[model samples]
Target: MTQIDRTMSLVRRAVDERISQAIAERRDEWSDAGPAAAELLDAAADLLGGGKRMRAVLAAIALSATADSARREDVLSGRACAGLGAALELYQASALIHDDVIDGALTRRGLPAAHRRFATAHRGSHWLGDAEAHGRSAAILLGDLLLSAAGSELGAALAQCPQGTRAAGRAAFDAMAEEVALGQYLDVRTESLPLPDEGADHAAAGRAMEEAALAVVRRKSARYSVMHPLLIGALLGGLPPHGEGARRLAELGEATGIAFQLRDDELGVFGDPARTGKPAGDDLREGKRTVLLALAWQRCDAGGRAILRRVLANTRADPAEIAAAAAIIEECGARAAHEERIDEHAERARRALEALITAEAGLSRSATADLASVISLLTDRSA
Candidate 1:
């Protein structure tokens, strides 16, 4: 197998093992609950079952690239690195559980959301007060549980690392968790704020909102998703803090994260339900004030502006309204603008990788190429 393929295989195996271990641990702890606990376990298992494993893949590759070849004698010896990836995945699950509650989403990955599933089970079992409240409350607790589990798991993984490498990994994991929460807060706050008024200083409001959204994206998605994971891997691999390879990885990660988020935004708006596992135009319905939306609003004319407002105001927008919103966005050139932004980020990421290879003779060209390929795949993905 090619290096990328081999790396991905290792990552997948590591993730599977971690998830399986997580399930077994939870099962052992909750065994007395029997079938109900089994159901919850199943829910938890389902939650962790499938994903792109992008963060995990990045972590493994980053460690492999920077670690001394002698140290990486075995793939599983990189458990600390894989643990970082598992932490990210668990963090994603926690965020999604809470997000489903906040957004009132019914399904995720073609299954009822955690809250809904818990609530339904609670109702059937007759062990609760209000079923809905029970479900929401339970989901909240479960999210917390998952987050805690992620941390504990990360600690376990880090424990296997040499003493010199453990601190750096811990620092990265801490920053990732903290930053993602702050970003999520910004996003929830943005939803409540009114859009810019007609005759209002459109430029000011649009810029302000866009900046806020961008900041949120940076913290909530980009930094945690790509930058920190890669950083942790490099650190665990014994790359010095100011090493050329480490610095370059940071730059590459930032650009990759931006592109990754932009792709998510695009999927939110344009992705097919079958592929994306989200309803068409879900972002619009959720009134997510994305950078793309802000750009569209800024460029639209008066009539187009009115159409945008109408779409946003409708709580239950039909397909026609969604299409109209999309059309206005396209007509105003926002789609092209968004695409340009994606390209810009992708180029910056490539440049960062180039700089790394140039500055660090120890940096493997094959590893750098693998990262570049991953970035290309992310930027080009449709869903």
Candidate 2:
């Protein structure tokens, strides 16, 4: 396996081990709560069973980059780093579970989403009124449970860190959690904001849409997905969290994270189900106000705009209409523009990392290379 692959495997194992142990403890502690509680833990296990472990891998990479050479191997192999990686994974799981509920997504990672799974179980067991409602309610609590677990795990991880650095780590974690919640709220509110019609000034409307979408990306995905993880890992590695190195890593993370989300937006509408594990045109059905859609609005004629409006949020839109909307996006050069934008963000991230390494911003050479490789993989992918 490649170095990155090996690192991912190790981190995945650590994440799985941590999750299993935590869930088992919870299951035992809550046995008095009855079968309903047992089922909740089962759902958590299922949802946490598999993933790319991107956030965990990033945390490991940053720890390697910042930790002193004499202590590096020990730190990487010790419980502290493993716990931190696991904590990040659990946090990511919390976000995803809640997001799927928000999006009404039926599946995640090729399996029923948390809410859907609960609903299916409820129906199978012939439970009481409103299986779907029960599912949504349970899934929300499941997400919250995972969030609590994440905090507990982070606390365990921090206890292993030096006294001076623990507060920084905790602060970073809290900031990430708060930012993502606010970002998600912005995303929901943006979806409610009406899209401008063809008669609206194209430039102004396009700019407003793009700005709104990018705001969601910045807070909801960018810093939450990349920057905070990097900072937390760096803090664990004994680097001062607010130092020049942290600043540089934040720059790299924000740019890389934005590119990652933009690519995800592109894939959401046009990517193959087999590869992306999501139905084609799902984003259109969900009416996500992505930058790609914003750009398409800018370039589309009235006829094309009408077609988009017809299918943009219409979950019942026929497959043919969805295909036409995708076609219009491609024809009007929105897809191409979106790709160019992703490239710009990715290149900026690469440059920031290069500068960090060249100026001895504290990252080791190998760790920097690994971070670069991961950034490329994240931004340029089929899924």
Candidate 3:
């Protein structure tokens, strides 16, 4: 494995241990509540157990990017960074739990989604008014529990840093929560709007669609997933958002995040089920208004545009229509355009990382190089 891989592996081990600690404490704290409480904690653990732990690693990268003269070892082992990786993982788990319910996704990472699992359990117990409703309600509460858990752990992480640094990091975390909630609402609003007529003001509608799609990425994932994590890590490392090295990290984070989500948008429509652990054309079937689809609709002929609209309008699309939609996406070259955008963002992130190497940040040469590799792995991922 590469050096970054090895380091992340070790970091993952640490983070997992911290996660276990969070679970254990919660389990005890809620012990008086009943067995149902245990189930919620278990659900959170199940969701947290898997994945690449990319957010945690990105946070680590930001923490390490401060001046080489800073005490690297002390920072890594200190409270400011401690439990942070696990905290991020928990926060993500909470988001996914709610996301699965919102999207009506059946599975996550090859397992039944949390609500589905809870519904199954409710059905098996034979004590529910509506098993599915029960499951959804439980999952919502479970998501709330996870948010609280993540916040608690984050508070602990901040406590280990200086007061100024702690305050700044906490602010970033708070802003992240607010932005993601608002972004999700925006996404819901956009999805509910009527489809525009291709014959009337097609150019203007297409432009508006593209703008809306990019806005989703910007607010929902770019800042929430990548930028805030970097800012929080940098703050913990003793630099505010405008601090030395912070701007570069922020720029790199935004670019990497945009590329990352764009890659996901591609995979949602084109990824292999076995590799991605999800059904083929899942996003297409769900009528996700991705930038890819918007661009495809923009360039396709009238007949092709009709097909696109027909498939998207049918949320219960069968395999044949899903296949047809995928074909249309490719034939219109929307996939290529989306990929080109990914390449652009990836290059931007690469340049940002490279510039940081010789910049005034004074990051250790080894840490700087490892960060470059990390950026590559993040943007170039397939599954």
Candidate 4:
């Protein structure tokens, strides 16, 4: 296997094992509490099992810059890397638990979503008041539990690292957690708010809409998924900065993450269900006000704009309407436009990657190359 694949495999193993161990310990701790603990632990484990392990992989990639060839494997297996990798994955599990609740999504990683799983149980067991309400309440608490566990995991990981490094890593993790929560609020808010007005200028209003959606992307995806993990890992890895590009990693990471999120926006609207693991046009069904929809408003005609504004976020919009919305997006050139933006940000990330690597000492060319290679996977993958 390629070095990238190998590193990812190892990190993936570390994430799984770490998360499993954490849940098992919790299970043991709550052994006297009965099946409720079992349900919560099982849900957390299931969510943790579903991700691409990309966040953990990003952490490992940052660590690679500080390790020599022989020590790379050592570093991966070290207490530090294992701790960081596991911590990052566990944190993601917490986020997904809440995200599913917010999005009202029925599935995650091809399985029933956390909230839905609970609701299904409530219905199947034929017990309780409203199944959905009970499910939502359980999910809220479960998400909170995972969030707390993630913080504990981070604290544990930091215990063995230098004080300065620990502080930096913790700062990134805490900042990201806060941003994601607020970002989710902004997303929910955007969906509830009316479209921006631009008098007779459909184009200007479209730009306004796009800006709002991009705001959600910046907080919810770019910072949360990619940038913060890079910061936390690099800080924990303790690689000193050295070149002109030394200070730009944050900007680079953010740009790279935005591109990744924009691709996700596209997939939400036009993705294949079998590959994406959610229903096709699930975004439309949920009425998510993404950049894709914003761009459609900006560029399309009045009929197209009305079509989007009318049906894009209805949640009750039908399949024919969803299909019509998708067609309008492609026809009005939003799909192409959104794709162009993804390419633009990806190119920006490439430049930033080179700069960040060049800014650091002892970063191998292959290490630089490996980090660069992940951009495509982030932006172009089907699932």
Q: lDDT: which candidate is best? A: 2
For model 1, the superposed segments whose C-alpha errors exceed 4 Å read 67-73, 76-78, 123-128, 313-315
Candidate 3 least-lDDT 10 residues: 69-78
List the candidates' TM-scores in order.
Answer: 0.93, 0.96, 0.94, 0.95
Give one digit per residue, the lDDT tens place, for model 1 in 1-383: 87677667778788878878888988999999888678766877898897778888887777777545555425433576567678778878888899888877777877789999989988888884898998888788888878888888788878876789888878887888888888888888888888888988776777787788788789878888889888887787677867777788888998989888988897888888888887777788888888888888778887887887777635688999898888998888988989998999999999998888888636566577678888888788877
Per-residue lDDT over 241-341 for candidate 4, one digit per residue giving the tens place of the 0 to 100 score: 33354356676778889999998889888888888888778887777888888888878887776677667567777788888889999998899999999
Query: What's the residue-level lDDT of 54 in candidate 3?
Result: 77
Candidate 2: residue 198 lDDT (0-100): 62
TM-score of 2: 0.96
Question: Each model's C-alpha lDDT?
Answer: 0.81, 0.86, 0.80, 0.80
Candidate 2, backbone clash total: 0
Q: Compute the lDDT for candidate 3.
A: 0.80
Over 4 Å off in model 3, which ranges? Answer: 67-79
Model 2: per-residue Cα lDDT over 1-383, one tens digit each: 88667667766677678778989999899999999888988888887887887887788778777666666556565677778887888888889999999989988988899999999988999988999998899999999989989989999988887888888888988999999999999998998888896678986798789999999999999888888888888877777766777778899999999999999999998998988888889999989999999999989888999999999778898889999999999999999999999999999999889777776667876577778898899899989
Rank the models by TM-score, top first.
2, 4, 3, 1
In candidate 4, position 91 carries an lDDT of 72
Best by TM-score: 2
Clashing pairs in 1: none
